[model samples]
Target: MAANALLKTQSPTFASPNSALDNIVLEYSISYFLIDLLHYLIFFPTDILFILHHLATLYVFLTCRYIIHHGAFAFFMLLILAEVTSLCQNIWTLAGFRRADLPAAAKLYEFLSPPFYALYTLVRGILGPLLVYKMVVFYLSGVAENLIPRWAWVSWMFVIITAILVSIVWVFDHWVDWFKGRNYKAAKKVV
Candidate 1:
């Protein structure tokens, strides 16, 4: 009964859409898929070579950005380049996974296999911070007055410290797990 209710809540229903509209939607989907494949082929390099180039590109970009006193326009251009490269890298990754037949697509599907709640959580976690930060930055830039209070700055400092401490702890834990392997098994068991 619970599973049935879950399925009902999750499943999409087409409430008698006209045949013409349905055909249009199908045509759009096919076009989108073809375009995606074309982009993948044209933009992305093959597997190992692409990985090496991706890493090299990232290193060069970061090094140059850090060393050079580029204007905002230059920074923006670099950001755009980074975005395009990243997109191409992702496409190459997906293609490599597909060619390897290493359950690449299945792994993505499995991430939200439990359905609606799992999908919701995944989307929320990924997009929530991104949307919030974009809005905050936009608003902060527009308004001259400091939106974040002095106290809020202190709170942020604390959060940063806590994050650093947590990361350190995680690194130590992972190191211990690697050394013992028993600890790794125990950690997985706890999870």
Candidate 2:
């Protein structure tokens, strides 16, 4: 989807009508988020953050797919930025969960951590914000008000901005931990 968005000569805009491909992508994304939201609600009921994230994501996809029938291009591009590091991050997280019990998992976690963190930081902290800024600029210009309503774009921006902020904070916390561990190791060596 991201490749499609990037490679298309005639780029779809926030106001462009949904293509057949866009509908497929939007439906798949909506289903994934809905199922994940249900899982969190049932098993991790107290996991408010994940639940809210899923809900917010569903809102964006649902609105884009059903309500506005536009903005798939924007959503697809953002999806690319948001999910580029998901596989690596997921592997790292799974390894982390088992690291204490298994030496191999620990090794894998250690090996993957730095690269994953770097990629994630670059994508979420830098690229994501850049793309979002462009999206915001376009949306706020009121060019697409007829196709995509003001309220929809404004709410989407709110959700996107909040998600990005949370991602930045999450990655920053990891970076702090990594630096502290490195410093501690260096001090221990000196001692």
Candidate 3:
């Protein structure tokens, strides 16, 4: 849906107004965030990072949907990029949660960790930042001033950069852990 909206736009910038398709996609994303926020609040209340992330995301989507009625192009692009790894991430996370108790889950977790980390790092660390840098540069050039106010774009940048940094740190930690485990196994085998 988001990709379709982006494709339909003749030439999209960060400040493009919300089309009907854009609104539909934005609404779908908004619903996802809202439900996910509630899930976090109910089941994972201690996970403040995810909670705050959901809140910040909701703020961006809601403002774009109702208040500004623009910026869907940038947000939708970011959404598609961010979600590209979600399936793999979710599987890895579920396996991680059950790994200690289930042998099958342990195997799955071990199998998926490296690939998940690599894919996540590539998307969140490299591609995401490049796109956001473009957004920052475009907005800083003051071309979108009439469409998206300074406050809106600034807030969006803050949320996006923060989220990407957190994701990078998370995947980096996994990579470190994976390497350490491999080295431990190799040392034990030599002994």
lDDT of each: 0.36, 0.87, 0.92
| Candidate 2 collision pairs | none
Predicted structure with the largest lDDT when compared to the true one:
3
Residue range 1-191, candidate 3, lDDT tens digits: 99999999867888998999999999999999999999999999999989999999999999999999989999988898989999999999999999999999999999998888889898889999999999999999999999899998998899889999998888888899899999999999999
Could you tell me how far off, in angstroms, the CA of residue 120 lies in candidate 1 after the best superposition?
28
Give the runs in model 2 whose Cα sits over 4 Å from its true position: 1-11
- Give the per-residue lDDT of model 1 (tens digit) for 99-179: 546676645533322342233233333333343344345434533124334343233333323433443453356445445
lDDT for 175 in candidate 1 is 44
In terms of lDDT, which candidate is stronger, 2 or 3?
A: 3
Model 2 misses residue 81 by how many Å? Answer: 1.3
lDDT of 2 by residue, 30-85 (tens): 98898989988998899898899999999999998888888888888889887899
Query: Candidate 3, overall lDDT?
Result: 0.92
Worst 10 residues of 2 by lDDT: 2-11
Candidate 3 residue pairs in clash (backbone atoms < 3 Å): none
Model 2 TM-score, all chains together:
0.92
